[model samples]
Target: MNYTLHQLQVFLKISQTLSITRAAEELNLTQPAVSIQLRNLQDQFDIPLTEVIGRRLYLTDFGREIALAAEKVLNEAYAINHRTLAHKGLLYGKLKVSVVSTGKYVMPYFLTEFMRQHEGIELVMDVTNRQKVVDSVANNEVDFALVSILPPHLNVARLDLMPNKLYLVGAGPTGQLREEAEPELLKKLPLIYREAGSGTRQMMESFLAAHQIVVKKRLELTSNEAVKQALLAGLGYSVMPLIGLKSELLNNDLQILPMAGLPLQTVWMLIWPKDKQFSPVAQAYLAYIRDHKDAIVQQHFGWYERFL
Candidate 1:
């Protein structure tokens, strides 16, 4: 039997609520109509859908199977509705965005501010490592990603929404270490770098490579905080983005070492497909990021002078 969208919807309602009376109330249909729809669907599949157990309705094995399929059909119908709505400039749908863990410190402020301005839009954020963020955007799993930097040819489009300066942090020995802690300072100490494929790590490597400052013996770790802690513990010094430890530097827990030609300044980028640009709401967020990024840093870092 050919199933209609209404029948699929009613069946899903019953499947979710597990009560024919409640499903009818939700669909604004009589109980008899709801029962008839479920029967028609069960008959089409030639299977038993429900059984009476202890005076409560229970799904038979076949009924459970059909309910799952029916839910998928209902979901697809909703997706089609959303796609049409999107085409009409509605911008009122789930926008999945992924970001590297480090960007969690900065990107959210811009995104939250944008959401407050566009109340109709719904946002879903998936925060993970930098590699995962890039992969999600590359495979179309996420519509956009905010990361420190992208690969040389990552098969996507990118926009540097705002400038992001790298900071050399340490609470270790001063003078020899601090004086040589600039972007070109990697050669002076055993540099503790983030794991490979980290947007931050990769950017730092490329910058150092460009300046011909190969680290003497590079040690790799995973998180930004770990690197900072190691530096403060006097394990080794590391280069990190200013966004990650802006507060620590300001609070005197860490010191930003002064170095010559070190920490080649890069920026946080809003990355997406070269083929599929961005939705109108996404464009708006990008604009707001550029306009208000400096203010965001000033608010979070406390002492605005450090950022400059």
Candidate 2:
């Protein structure tokens, strides 16, 4: 009860990042300052909030509960601030977005245009993998999320954003592999795979399952860029989203292998919890992207056609 919202804010940031250093950097505060705020905040509680184990930081059970409560408090506070600005006829607020890694290719364009139109808006974007994005959605940690696969259990409002086409890509001459999309041929080739919990990896698994194929998992990469680099080095083939491969495809650093039932088509969706109230800025962005999806896609992604 003695803690200020500032303390809660700092604690929440630390909880989200699991790094006092990162939380301090994000909040534009010194590490000592952040530590002081955390110390002051924890003084009011009888139980320890967090623990450091083997150079890694973790929230205790009580810390996790308090972090969740802090999020709700901050969200409501922001909502009030939004209303106050609206009363003054001002468009000033923060927009928090959590996006899956592949969505990094598309979200910046949308956010750039939106921020350009509203100079007072603050944007906080987290580009994480699908699992983290899903956790954000589940925990109501972000205003919106951009992802390829929608979680079936969450009650959410989904707006279809754009098509996400995944291709089986590799380095080397285009015809080095057999022309046919045969399971036997693909199984023999070295495959570079995204780490587990990736939406792309899950989709690739389903695609391979449909074909009854099992590939040689030569490398497991943590990021799309890593996978792309491995492909360029001829380390292995991978199923990659076309959005992530536009430049490489154009430069002939990578080639999409010809195959039956390839280029698996999925749709990107913008989602927020159905029950959550949106701030004026969040509502405006939702409407703007919905209204301008085609133009946005054409403007940002028109180059895709020349390569396709």
Candidate 3:
């Protein structure tokens, strides 16, 4: 059976998302276009690769197997192109990284110069919750994963990028509460939170549990931006990363509540599975990050040091 690389590419996206609409959106193709490609790819195989049940798409066992094969094929294809570019003294290929949601703020600063220099590189940065980022690393779906909290079970190598400082913050008009009154204040105030499986949420939970402080959970939001909006609307306070709150903090839109054990700290890390082979683009990224992380942090995040 013969299938074009584009068909395989389209099928791989479909397999990942399990939705024609989502695959189309991600691929920047029309839904009809995606469907046509999928149908064409399906025609090459006699057996069903996908099945629709209860209006939801599910890949057949054969589909899952083929998807894996398709990924290998695509990676090799990318490798071939990258190798040719490398011989011409240029880096080329896809650099896929999955980052925990709040990491979006940090990753871009590190990426800007590298991406600008390597114009031939294709960058795909997936911003999702901690669990998804971890899964991406575990499955080798991405070249690297950026996270604050490392998964204890995964055998991985990491490069520490910078400090991730989390503080309990609320809509501003700074209050003059003493450190001793902080826990009692938390008990009385409604707490906004990131959704479960978020690194921020995990850190917040652990902080509360350790201090034996139980907060009234007012709202749970999915993304950092959502949580920030909830804070701006004076909905509630949350433990938020300082990296994402620079403007808010400076403008007094949010105020960090100084508690006894305030500003819980973790290191932002670029992690990869220990045994995974790095692509040319991935290796170039690692090298660029290593050479420039210090300068990047000082340039982009120097204001952060004051909070520390």
The C-alpha RMSD in Å for every predicted model, in order, reads 10.5, 5.8, 4.9
Instruction: State in Å the error of residue 232, model 2.
Output: 0.9
Summing lDDT over every window of 10 consecutive residues in candidate 1, give the lowest-scoring window. Answer: 299-308
lDDT of 2 by residue, 42-144 (tens): 9999999999999999999999999999999988887888778778787888799999998999899887888888866889999998888988988999999
Query: Comparing 2 and 3 by TM-score, which wins?
Result: 3
Per-residue lDDT tens digits of candidate 3, residues 74-125?
9888888878878999978789999998999999998988999987799899
Using TM-score as the measure, name the better of candidate 1 and candidate 2. Answer: 2
- Backbone clashes, each candidate: 5, 0, 0
User: Between candidates 1 and 3, which one is better according to TM-score?
Assistant: 3
Best model number under lDDT = 3
Report how far residue 111 has shifted in candidate 2, in Å. 1.2
Q: Model 3 segments beyond 4 Å from truth?
A: 1-87, 174-180
Report the number of backbone clashes for model 3: 0
Off by over 4 Å in 1: 1-91, 154-157, 178-188, 207-218, 277-305
- All models: lDDT? 0.75, 0.88, 0.90
Which 10 consecutive residues of model 2 have the lowest summed lDDT? 173-182
TM-score of 2: 0.74
